[model samples]
Target: MAYDADTSIDLTQYRSLIDLIESSAKRYGDKTAYVCLGKATSFNEIERDSRYFAAYLQHHTELQVGDRIAIQLPNITQFVIAAYGAIRAGLVLVNTNPLYTERELIHQFNDSGAKALVVLSDLLPTLNNVVASTQLKTVITTHALDLIAPQPQSQCEFTTITFTKVLAEGSCLAFTPVSAKLEDLAALQYTGGTTGLSKGAMLSHRNLIANAMQIKSRLSDRLVQGEEIFVAPLPVYHIYAFMVNLVLYFERGGCSVLIPNPRDIASLIKTLSEHPFTGFAGLNTLFVGLCHQPEFKSLNFSHLKVTISGGTALTQAAANVWQATTGCTISEGYGLSETSPVVSLNAPGLEQLGTIGKPVIETQVKILDLNDQEVPPGETGELAVKGPQVMSGYWNKPQETAMVMTQDGYFKTGDIAIATEDGFHKIVDRKKDMIIVSGFNVYPNEVEEVLSAHKEILECAVIGVEHEHSGEAVKAVIVLSSLSQDLEQTKADILRYCREQLTAYKVPKIIEFMESLPKSTVGKILRRELRN
Candidate 1:
């Protein structure tokens, strides 16, 4: 888990990822940086657009240096412009899920104290309701076609400030040059709020650049200078996809075939069949979902050289089906929002089918017990990581941040894993009671806490149950203080309340009523016992 030798990346090439785009704009100015819905954005065009947006934000808005800006958009080209523009403006970025509810959206916006938000048109209603309570002032919205050229600018149905307006306003605004250091905070990635509440992991520019290089060094041969093609279906808001597909891939001047909506499996299959891809990265359920589709067998993946799976364990069955359909194995890996999302991965050259491979270049991983003592190899323990890619700390939550970080700068991942002799590692369990439903982490503690607050429920416990489509489904066991006079109506009420408060994946599928609950000797609820 510990590296004795050096794992340094050459810093002479570029100071940060933004610098990579700037450098590429100079070298491969006319090359395509992004491809979406048959429309492409050239490297030079991207640079000019981002710089203009950055200049506009700095001059028009009162956002100071290091102020956070929330970005909630899909896999469209605006995401790239907004992301790079925020960074270039010397502001930290806070990526948000477009599917978040008003409550979930409010929590993150307030927690990060975001000064502005650049969101898609469709998700504006969710943001509009909560903007009053949050510190956010400037709200910039764009349509999907705004990023693509040769389209009429007046063809947008969205109701907000458009890109055209921003450019016009920026005409008279004064531009101030600001220098952003390599070690400055770049992103505040919020953890998957499955445990209790989400915490923002503060990642610096150096952390993100180092992680990209770590991945680049491992697959340098497969990824040519400017010819690499990646199938980017995962949500850009998620850390895994953002780092691998958006940040790292774009920094290399590579091409990404964007899948705006992955839920449409048929459309995804057609898109894959039409294009040639060199790399594909996603979670276990995505591969499983595709393989189960009847049309998946007809797609051609002969050109694919590298495949990666993360965010959860790669089930053995899913791996076999993928390898059988395509001549390449699906390399499983592990990471968290705290590690710039790439800590370890199964190297394509030397991969174990069922295990997430060793730590990436410049990263060190260790398995430790509750006492922070190192555990023997092949034994399950909490996975701890220390590297340039690891987050500096959580934003504003000093006590919560200090609770997970070690004195030596290692972040306790809270994931249980066993490291093999061949450096392959397999995830066993998560310290936080979390259920991954449809490749999304659903925290039981958060659900249980919310359910227990209900007037009908006295105590509750939540656990994951096996499911074929979604890897796992949330199931809740409740001990009511008073017997339900109308059981069916009470169940419906609880489900309805959960739907309003939680996301679709986090809602419990099954609700069981109990007269009494299982507990430890100290009267603490035993969630493990409820699993049975």
Candidate 2:
């Protein structure tokens, strides 16, 4: 509704994401493309290194054009090189979380059927036990300082080669050009499902390119070509950052200052002080955590013009504190992994607080009732979106895909929303039992499955509780077995076991023991009663 038919754009210029990468390299060769751990990698360097990495994947490995390559590293320069190279080699990028447990890694790797993996060196000890269980054949490891200088190599059953070595070997080999069509799969981004395990959302080059262009067009007034510097604290593996930092900012010739660990608030604040960033991307907790630090408030805010918020709903508390500190208004956006992540973002100046502003250009969003018909104006209902940025469907799961998609083309986002009379959309509640901790989606069933496996626990129900630090924290209520000994000790043991199976964000922060969990007459656990 924002743009008319006359302003509608076509995708004739850029063939694929590769075109955007090469175009930026040529335009801003000497400009900084990415900065990580005090080192700046220019656009030309990214181009050359990515080309080398792609060459090795093409000539050295036994990988085909459409094979999946998993990348499990924090926000580092290697992530950019590896992601770009994998795409250039005509392979589908499977962006993996660096903090994923062995169980998670096994499910994702086997689900995506990834043949190769590029992981952090420190994680090799963990991956050492897991790689043999998956379909991964080639494992390339890299340290944080690998690009700056060769770091000591760590060994594992499969992770014997370093990322540096691949680049060097690739430089010698004659590189063959691999062209991927826009309709081809670019990445398999995994998102938490209602089921215990997660599923991969198949995204095409067109889906990504369209979203990037759509957001860019929306924020055209704020972003300046070759001048903007976007501080990226969120994980690059996530679709939100992947679309914003990797595609949008990179194509616009903006430098992304990568923060490896956002949990380390001091280090994150220090990184901010070093760069005269023009833009920032973060979630509610990150915004609140950074604002609480004394070192953060004193930083220069003159250069900061736009602050983008996604991942979780932006709390009014976070928005107020961030604006009071950075002197920049927070533009909160609403999206899901199935939508290449951004459907609506608050407009730059006309931002209406407590609302996700308006839908981006070429995006159609409407609320649907229980009968799948359009809800009355200003009435809360399920939000369904029809957009070019929307993912084709969930990978390799026809039934799951059919469940979310409508008869027409709209993808039914499992969140309750209300459309304002003035064209703004506001999300009110989640239709699914998903818990959002910090910016990550944690499913109740996923955590409950892990807790149920513990010998000490009989039955468990996981629910989201309001957390001051993380937007919401996972709270597990359990009905202990008769065999259980000390209640407190059992709680500790169950939590310890959960940490081993689930990621840090997915683990239950609070555990409660009760005689029995609240359930209905049919014996189904009532999670709402637990939350109450």
Candidate 3:
């Protein structure tokens, strides 16, 4: 079923991601596509640069058709180029967090078996420690100058180079053009597991393209092609922001105001004031942070048409505050890593407070009980989704893949929700023990498993706590068999170990000691009791 419109085309019909970028460039060549700092990048430049990067990859490196290429950069121009370059060069793209520790980086690099990596220069120290252990053969590094123009002084002291200089070291090899099908693998998005492991979700080109088109089609009414500006504060490595900010932005030829560091409210607010943004995509924490800042009240949001909230449940208080201040509600949505990150969203025009709107085009959503039977409307049950955006499966994990993927192709989202009579769905809670800190998933089991290895801890349980900015923060409750003289130092040591092992978001912000954790008669730890 192809959606027909005079100006809109089915984005999934394209064979490669580059095809959409190329077509949009031709249609809106002179229009600004992205803005950073004070400078703007036109669609023509984005197209030309991505093409050059693709040609460079084909010229250098043994990257062949269907090979996986890792992109480990921040929200910079090189990221977009490397992403489209690999896809156009017929290579599967592997998205990695730029702040990953050596252990985290090595796991994803080795698991994906990617042959090449494109990284930012300042993050080289982290990558340098791990690349030796992976099967990666080529490395491409970019400087800050590659993305933003020269600064008056070094606000950030990080080493990086242009892609031209990095590619000069290797001999260029012939790469196949866009010959892969839309159903072929395009990305391997690695998500943290329930069992304290990370597994890559294989998202095909069709999966991503379908999501982009579906989102674009829905927003097409209010969104004017080549005239709208999208605030991309969320990282593109995350699928929710990637589809809306990166993929859909390109599809509609809209300008993306890139926020390099969203954690810094001052800088993010400065960017918001610098541009005439029409659409803003972020989670609850970002909005809460914006409202907390003293200068936030003065920021102009009259041009803004929509605010998309995902990555976690948005509270009624946060939504009400944003609406009162900006005259626009933060539209909440629901998804998981396996569903290309977006299965349902509250359409901008039909947004309902506290609900993750309706299902997008060509998508089916259902609420099922423990017996897989459909639950009545307004009844709490597990949310299951079937759509083109659903991932193929977990990479190389058939047993794990079969566990989540239903026989009829629906992906179990592991989120407890209820559909209202009006067709809007609200998330009651998560069935999995995953903590969302500042819109990033922090698996408590993984944190607890790491804390248990501490010499001072006999057993530990990690849970989420109400946070002002992060929405939810990791808190560790531990049982110590032996009491040490320096308990404070021991707690510090435990946190330090977790920082070294896990991502910063997964680290525990609060550490509390307990005699023993409440458990069921069968010896299963009661996480619900910990929440109380």
In terms of lDDT, the best-performing candidate is 2
> In model 3, where is the ten-residue run with the lowest total lDDT?
151-160
In model 1, the Cα lDDT at residue 514 comes to 90
Could you give candidate 3's per-residue lDDT for residues 426-477 as a string of tens digits?
A: 8888866888888788887778877888788898899999887677889999
Per-residue alpha-carbon lDDT of model 1 for 409-502, expressed as tens digits?
A: 8899888889888777788777657788876788888888778888999888899999877878999998887987998899999999998788
Top candidate, metric TM-score: 2
Q: Give TM per candidate.
A: 0.93, 0.97, 0.92
User: Which residue pairs overlap in candidate 3's backbone?
Assistant: 59-172, 59-173, 60-172, 143-160, 143-161
lDDT of 2 by residue, 410-506 (tens): 8999999998888998889985578888878899998888888887778999999998888789999988777566777877788788889989989
TM-score for candidate 2: 0.97
Candidates 1 and 2 compared by lDDT, better number:
2
lDDT score of residue 231 within candidate 1 = 88
Prediction-by-prediction clash tally: 1, 0, 5
Query: Cα lDDT of all candidates, in order?
Result: 0.81, 0.89, 0.79
| Better model by lDDT: candidate 1 vs candidate 3 | 1
Error of 1 at 347 (Å): 1.1
